[model samples]
Target: MIIIDAGHGGVDPGANGHGVTEKDWTLEVSLHQYHFLRKLGIQCKVTRDRDVLLTPERRAALVKQSGAKVCISNHYNAGGGSGAEVIQSIYSKSKLAKQAADALMAAGMPVRRVFSRKGTAGDYYYMHRLTGSVETIIVEYGFLDSAIDMKKLSIRSFRLQLAEEAALAAVKYSRGVENSLYVVQSGAYYAKDKAEKLCEELKQKGYEAFVRRMN
Candidate 1:
């Protein structure tokens, strides 16, 4: 199962967004991601089903209870900042976190770098203390107040793009088996070129490789 948490809700309008509230946007994106994942046969559970106040602890408990392999906490950070930032569990070196973070980066999510805060930063976020080794990521997806970002969020097409990136990261990170798998991405550009180059390099290393283009 994959646990999706839409941060802050109800009367608590986390980071007011011009006329839009962070709570509302968070729920919207979270639901979008959850439904998309479910449609693809991935199990999903949310921390808050509707608008309501929930402490970080309660949210974390929900993640733990869901028996999720990964917890994706969706949120819109405040303070008039912009760009995407994902907080991964302290296992920064873990291949799972590396794959997820790299996927997001390669997909061009506006992020500086993925960081580990568990047991180091304040534990109130709940994502900090995990009952298991579940790979978790709390993504603060741009600022609601930023004019540039708000303009993008105003479009459903744009939000769906974000969800796509999240989905891409989830699949890549969760499935590490080396096999014949093709990731559908925007035309044969960076990823395509990279894959082609890797295939050639693998051949040099005495392994057959091929590049499959997506339609």
Candidate 2:
């Protein structure tokens, strides 16, 4: 299982830009990721499903309690800087964090860097500090303050792409693949109607079966 933190909620709106609030976007993306992963048979838990503020300590406690092996704290940057960044704990090096960041870059958000917390030994970020054994990383999707970034974020399709990429990365971190295919062929029909019939029947039986159109 994995823990996903939709950082900054309630009174904490996080970074704001182009009339969009970080809290709202974070929750939107996080929940999208949650459902996507769940559909792929990967268990996931979100810190806050709704617009409610959660202290870093409390969020960390939730991750610990969830017995999750990996965690991601989602946020948006506020500074004038543009592009995305993935930050790992000062205490550990995480290839999983890098993978997620790269996935985000592929989806659209240009990666500024994959880095760890600087200054002081041990955990620099509170959420990173308290996650215990869970390999946690902070994903700043893009600089909300940057006009270029905000313009991209304003697109609904872009946001959906970001959510989908995050879900793909999480699955990679846990299961080392986006999906484990389990194909169950119920029937084959040259007629499109018969194939659609079997597809609906499989869907009713709780199996995600589909028909393939071949040339």
Candidate 3:
């Protein structure tokens, strides 16, 4: 089961972006994810079904009561920044989490860093106190007010694309579980050979490296 928490509803909008309320967008995106999950035959529940305020403890308790297998807290980014990040609490661990993280990386989020505290996943909210499951992550999709992210939002299909992306990931991770890590190096260069050369230099520096070609 998936618990989708649309952060800061009711009185709390969390953050404002280009005149769009954070609460509204979060709820819309969360609902989209929920519907997509159901279409995939995945079970899910939301913290607030509508515009009701929920305390952190209350939200966490809801998750615990639902016997959910995973938790995803939906939120947006603020300021002049945009991208996606998955934040895990310091209390949960499971193969599903790792797979979910990798899927997010492949989903074309601005940032692809998975944060965990000692293999446990949760963010800076009620997720840790409430989640007793194997996988729990906070999804900060992108910055709302930033120039780059605002442009992304202007696209009618970005949020839906995100929902589709995350839904596919959730299906892969929570259902089709896999475990392992691969060496993925990131850099910028004009030519593919430059990347290959960098990989070679790193190998000489006593680190395992591989050159990946990109079109």
Candidate 4:
């Protein structure tokens, strides 16, 4: 099983810029990843599903309790950086982090780096140090303070795409499958009419298309 931790919530708003709040954006991405993983037949759990506060200690405890082998703590960066980054636990290798960085890069998000930080005690982040045996990864989707990042992250479609890609990376890492099969999806829409319209357009362009409802 994999655990998805949406960083910051409630009173802790995290980073905020360009009309986007870190807590809300992280939750949205985490929820999308959770559902996408489930659809792929992968067991998954999320730390918080709504606008609620969860301390670092509490979030780490939940990840350990879940017995999930992998925990993804999602956050939007702030500190003037313009690219995505994946921080792996110092104890873990860079495999998963590299995969995540690659996915973000493929989606046109610049990747700052895939590396681990260390504190005087041990792992730099609480999510890694306190999460017991779970392999915890801190993913900074992009810097919320940067206009370049917000330009893409502000779009619902782009955020959903990132969620799916992150989920896929987790699935690949946990399953140890180098050649996993992936489905090509054009888009995900909330409105049935919008989806059907896309389907019709695809069909008209000499492609086989259908609108499948998501439960």
Q: Pick the candidate with the highest TM-score.
A: 4
Off by over 4 Å in 2: 119-121, 177-200, 204-206, 209-215
lDDT of 2 by residue, 41-143 (tens): 6788999999998877788899878888888888889868998888998776677777888788878789888888765647778777777888888888888
Error of 1 at 72 (Å): 0.5
Ordered by TM-score, highest first, the candidates read 4, 2, 1, 3
- Pairs of residues clashing in candidate 3: 88-121, 88-122, 89-121, 89-122
- lDDT agreement with native, every candidate: 0.67, 0.81, 0.69, 0.87
RMSD of each: 9.2, 5.1, 13.0, 5.5
Model 4: residue 214 alpha-carbon error in angstroms: 12
lDDT of 1 by residue, 30-90 (tens): 8877776765556787888789998766677777778777777777766767777777666
Q: Rank the candidates by lDDT, best first.
A: 4, 2, 3, 1
Which portions of model 1 show Cα errors greater than 4 Å?
A: 94-108, 118-124, 177-215
Which pairs of residues collide in candidate 2? none
Q: If scored against the real structure, what TM-score would every candidate get?
A: 0.72, 0.83, 0.72, 0.85
Considering every candidate listed, which one attains the maximal lDDT? 4
Error of 4 at 142 (Å): 0.5
Output the lDDT of residue 99, model 1: 55
The candidate 4 region of ten consecutive residues with least summed lDDT is 206-215
